[model samples]
Target: MDQYAVFGNPISHSKSPAIHTMFAKQTQQAMEYGVIEAPLDGFEKAVGEFIHRGGQGANVTLPFKQQAFALADQLSEAARLAEAVNTLSFNKGRIYGDNTDGKGLVADLKLQGVTLTDARILLLGAGGAARGVIAPLLSELPASIHVANRTEQRAVELAVQNPSSKLVASGLDNIEGEFDLVINASSASLAGSVPSIRGPLVADAVCYDMVYAATVTPFNLWARQQGASRTIDGLGMLVCQAAESFAIWRGVRPDVNPVMQFLRAQMTQSL
Candidate 1:
């Protein structure tokens, strides 16, 4: 069996193993997926050991994504643009890296019937999560994207990294105008809080939170309270991105709907 795993610092809570297992079963691929909790300072060593043990590929999470980018022998355009690598493949002596998060986000938005063409977008936060999805979002020809962060400089830096006339930057407090879509990529949702932005930004907009929980995420719930047209959590993005990584390793795509349904049921039951 081909061996694969997701690597991170605190990896016990990851759902990647279950998601990939379902993908493997659905695609009839003979592979094993698991998790590796690498020490903060020992990431490279851990990856080397996995490769030595015949590991085929691995998914990276959190702090390790940037490290994986530096370790790759070759990088896909998405990974290069994102400056992070969430998916990795090993063949012979070469390690190939790619970032599937943006593709996954765009795919999920399309699946949910959210229009991206020529829409005004508000992206909250300028962290890695925000960076990974900007390119894909821009590809859809959105009329404009305003990136807002607590630290205005960081958001401005992110906009400069991906220079486009359609993109702009601002501090959260300085955010202006209503958006057709509001995407929460900040860590506020993880703390059960919503980003500090005006309610009108989300009103009548499609609100998406890049954080998932058993119930609606804090950001999504807050968006709904502000009369958002629709609200979605990140579970679909997680599944879709994992499917992208699986396809990279197996050369076959697995149906995501059934897997998403199964995971949703599990989340509800746990609640």
Candidate 2:
């Protein structure tokens, strides 16, 4: 089997192995996927060892995506804009990096029947997760994109880095207007917290939380309570992004719908 794995500091909870294993089986590809827990400070060493062991590709998660970006021999355009890498393809001693998170999120949103064209978007958080999605979202030609963060300056910096006449930044508490779409890319949801943005969300707005759990995320729950027309979790994005990485490694794209259905059933069973 061609070896592949996902590398992260706290990796035991990752679903990449199961997701990629299913992709391999369905595509009739001879590959093995697993998880590698790199020590917090040992990401480079861990990647080196994986390469030495003939690992052909890997997914990167949390606290290490930026480091993986730095380690890449070359980067896809999305990775270059995001300045973060979630997928790495090892080719003849060269490591190529790409960011599939934004692609996945956009794909999932389209699947959910959310339109991005000329939409007003509110992105919550100024972290790497938020950064990873901005470029892809911009490609959709949204009317405007407002980034809100607890630390106002970080939001300003991120917007400046990806300057756009349509893009603006604000403190979460001072979010001035409603939006057609609201995306939660903050770690706040992982901590069971919501971004400090209070609303009047746009009429019939769609809300998305990039963090997923067995139940609705705190952010999504709050959005629903605030009358969002629809709320989506991160599971679909996760599956779609993994499919993109699979394609990157195996040169074939697996159907994401079946994998998403299977994963949802699995999550339900576990709950």
Candidate 3:
């Protein structure tokens, strides 16, 4: 079987192994997928050893996405634009990197029947997670996009990175105006807290929390309390992104709906 894995620090909680295992079974691919917890300061060393052991590819998470980007011998447009890489394929002594997060988000949104064209978008947080998805969202040609962060300068910096007249930046405290789509790309949801912001912003808008829990995320709950039209968590995004990575490695696209439904059922039962 070909070897594949996901690498990260604090990787014990990762769902990548299970997700990929399901995909492998569904596609009847002869592959073994697992998780590797690399030491914080030794990500490169771990990757080198994995490649030495005939590892075929890897899914990178958390702090290592940027490092994976730097380690790539070649990058896809998605990886280059995001300045981060979440999927890596090794071939003929070279590593190819790509970012599937943005494509995953867009795919999930489309599956949910959310329209992006000519709508206003509010992106919370300007960090890697936010950066990875901005270009893809922009491709959907929203009327405008506003990136808000705790630090005003980071938001400004992110907006400037893409250099779009349709994009704007603001501090979280000063966020105003109605947004047809509000996406929480911040780490706040991991802490069971919503990103601090004033609203009227989420009112009647579709809200997406890029974090998923067995139940609704705190950000989505807050959006619901604020009378948002719809709220979605990141489970579908996770499955879609994993599917993209599988396609990259195996050259075949597997259906994501079944995997997503299976995972959702598991989450429900675990509760």
TM-score per prediction, in order, is 0.98, 0.97, 0.97
Off by over 4 Å in 2: none
lDDT of 2 by residue, 58-146 (tens): 99998799999999999999999889999999999999999999999999999888999999999999998998999999999999999
Cα lDDT over the full model 1: 0.94
- Which model scores highest in lDDT? 1
**How much does each candidate deviate from the true structure in C-alpha RMSD?**
0.9, 1.2, 1.1
Stretches of candidate 1 above 4 Å error? none
lDDT of 1 by residue, 1-271 (tens): 8999999989999999999999998888999999999999999899999999999999999889999999999999999989999999999989999999999999889888999999999999999999999999999999999999999999999999999999999999999988999999997877888889988888999999989888988888889999999999999999999999998999898999998899999999997
lDDT of 3 by residue, 1-271 (tens): 7999999989999989989999999999999999999999999999999999999999999879999999999999999988999999999999999999999999999998999999899999999999999999999999999999999999999988899999999999988788899999987877788888986889999999989889888899999999999999999999999999999999999888888999999999999
In TM-score terms, candidate 3 sits at: 0.97
**TM-score of candidate 2 on Cα atoms, chains taken together:** 0.97
| Model 3: CA > 4 A from native | none
Better of 2 and 3 by lDDT: 3
Clashes per candidate (backbone, < 3 Å): 0, 0, 0
Order candidates by lDDT, high to low.
1, 3, 2
Error of 3 at 224 (Å): 0.6
